[model samples]
Target chain A: MTDMVMYEEEYRQIQEVCARLHRDANASAVLLIDKNGQLISEAGDTGHLDTTSLSSLTAGNVAATGGIASLLKEKEFTGQFHEGEQINVHISIVAQRVILVILFDERSSLGLVRLRVRRASDELSSVFDSLLAKVQQPSTPSIFSEITDEDIDNLFKD
Target chain B: MSFINYSSREINCKIVYYGPGLCGKTTNLQYIYARTNPDAKGKMISLATETERTLFFDFLPLSLGEIRGFKTRFHLYTVPGQVFYDASRKLILKGVDGVVFVADSQIERTEANIESFDNLEHNLYEQGYDLAKIPYVVQYNKRDLPNVAPIAELRDLINPEQVPEFEAVATTGYGVFDTLKAVAKLVLTELKRGR
Candidate 1:
């Protein structure tokens, strides 16, 4: 299994990208989720929403859509939009490893969201590319060598 | 794939419950959801059909306490077990860090159990994961049923690798946490070995 490691530097970059996406697109919120459905970073007004479950479901939706893309002999559907009565969602794959999900209402237009997301996606892709390189560095010290069996048992102790 | 965030002090790992149709994969998740503290778990979401059969998957995000200042969160998922839903099953295994195969112990469902297990292996392989190399465990479920296979026979047939198999009756919550704990421990141990 591939491991996803987020260093402090990458977190700051992702937060900046998300904040810009939220403001520039006039969207309610911008969430950066891993393709595996883990919420990496979130910005904007997500107070009333359940980001955890939303992230997981969004990833599932993307994966299902990607499956459809394969059947159609395409690489992937880069963007998806779901219009709702009050709010709408726009999801896009960034760097092929992360998902950019934006939630907007009548205040924002689909055209604006797409434009901002595309720009932010490119910035985020570079940030993630560096993060991936750092994680794959062979010179990095091991996080587990010092961990003992007792350390693991202590975690599950009731 | 396990996501370790040094910035947030969180470690998120995906664990998928897999088995044949109506073989208690969803039941295992339901038991865990019911037992888990509300503060420690997210809402349980089931993407199912009108008949309540899982259509895509059932998702439960759980926090199993913290370890060394890092919150250990496990995202639990169950793949739809019907043969026709094989596509959905493969999609769910995309970044799985570990698997808990809930094999139906009923005598009549023996073949279904084997087929599902084989399918799991194939799907994992397609996603660039070798089943044997990843953290995994097996659960012989529905042990309370009188028509179930014996533990010894089930172990020989289902758990040839002997990866911490457990006997469970998920509906009653019997051995459910035990099975979960076993696989989670293996996953954490693997992480300690630096992936």
Candidate 2:
């Protein structure tokens, strides 16, 4: 199992990348979702959207696509764009661990979204690569080791 | 995979509920969704057939307060358990942090239980995850029904490794939270050990 620990600096960097993607692509929202369906960061308009559910479903979609890729003898689908009558979702795989999902309506074109996502994905990939390196360092302390059983029990407290 | 975000001070873990078809996997999620505080849970999503049988999966995102200032969020997923949905089941197991094997307790489905358990092992292995290394628990669901197998029999067959196991009737919420808590606890312990 790989541990994904995102420190403040890395989080800020990812936030900036997502914000830039939202701005440059004129997207409704941009989300950085882990391949396991956790939301790492978000930017732009997500007020009404259920980003949590969206993130989970997005990762599921990516996994299903990956299964198909394997069946076809391809590595994986690094980029996918789904067009809708009004809304569109563009997903790009980053560092093979995280997914960048850009949600847009008629406001943005697929060509522009793809172009911006390419740049943003590269930036996000580098940031996450470094993050993974930091997590992998042997010297990094285990955050859970210090917490007591009581602390864990308290989490279940109402 | 477990994700810890220092910026938000949150730890997110993925827990997948797996078992044979009609083993009460979805019922477990539904019970949790109904009983949990609204602030602690996100909307439940179910992609199911018109008859309400799960087609792809059911997802429920839950936040269990905070541990050492970091919110502990758990994403619960139930894969489609029908035999023909093997591909879908395999996809759902990717990156799973913990697993709850919800076995049907009825004696008539003994073979189905064994077959599904084997399928779970094979699918996890294909994803490069060893079942023994991952935090796992077993739930003997539908215990309220007649002709249920004895707890010892179920344990011997499905839980030979002797990880935490619970008896549950998910529809009425009996033992539902107990099963969830047991698996969640193991997941946290695994995290603490830096797994």
Candidate 3:
């Protein structure tokens, strides 16, 4: 059976790009999600991370914060900047369907992450949009999706 | 000529700490932050509810020096462990690499620990990542707790596959680095095989 999760390969590709973005921008973590808020991929240390939960939270934040932005008649929120004493989150939605969330410490600047992400968002959307389209079209299976009891069994046996 | 250019690099990896509630996932990152040298880490962000529970997640970034020419860094994250937050957990696991399954060692929290582990596997399958293929580790935290579960039982229940495991007291900073080191090593090792 095909794994229901979409964007695995695309997200994998994006992970590399996000890693570069994190290093270059001096940010903490970077998250990329679909418009529906399904997480596609991420970069940074996940040693203490439960990203499954974080992606939804980030999408929700974007939706709620975006609504407030619309109501306030501010520029529709392309992103959000939350400043804290130690850590901060920069939330940006790309191509309206994907949201890019950046986690950074005080050493990283909101200005820097925002600047780089604006460009990264567009680049990422273009790349992912194509990948999503590819997944929709081919419907071909790769060794990756060949997950089965045997696969799990053999892996565990090792 | 800026020494570091944010736009230059292109690869990003997202990792989430999967564990039961109050298992010190957040505390692990907190301890890392306390010890991390400035310039290597960015801000730490927490999304919390009025009750102070981790409403969403805690995020932090750490630079693991450099290997070869490319810089090896990690983005640390913690999910809200409450069972009701399953949807949130599902979202964060969307795209992840190297997971540190932080288990609460308290005997009473055993059920929570097991449930979360199952949830972690389920979520990964949904994301199309076989737990075996991804860089993985287990951390039996709260070693300092007086009523903690014995390490043997904890190991059997959670670390059955024995990818790698650590004993920790995240709140006091013990075992935090060990856990990070283990995961970082796994992530890098993955680069060798997959990259």
Per-residue lDDT of candidate 2, residues A24-123 (tens digit):
9999999999998988899999999899999999999999999899999999989888988878999989988998999999888999998998888889
**What DockQ, between 0 and 1, does each candidate earn?**
0.77, 0.76, 0.06
Candidate 1 residue-wise lDDT, A35-147, digit = tens: 99999999999999899999999999999999999999999999999999999999999999999999999999999999898899999999999988888888765455566
Q: Interface root mean square deviation of every model, in Å?
A: 1.5, 1.5, 13.4
Off by over 4 Å in 2: none
User: In what order do the candidates fall by TM-score, top score first?
Assistant: 1, 2, 3
Docking class of 3: incorrect
Better of 1 and 2 by DockQ: 1
- Which sections of candidate 1 miss by over 4 Å? none
lDDT of 3 by residue, A25-110 (tens): 89877877644334566788656876755764566577556556756998677767888888898887776666888889977787
lDDT, residue A40, candidate 3 = 65
The number of clashing residue pairs in model 3 is 49
Cα deviation of B100 in candidate 2 (Å)?
A: 0.6
Instruction: List the candidates' TM-scores in order.
Output: 0.98, 0.97, 0.61
The predicted structure with the larger lDDT, 2 or 3, is: 2
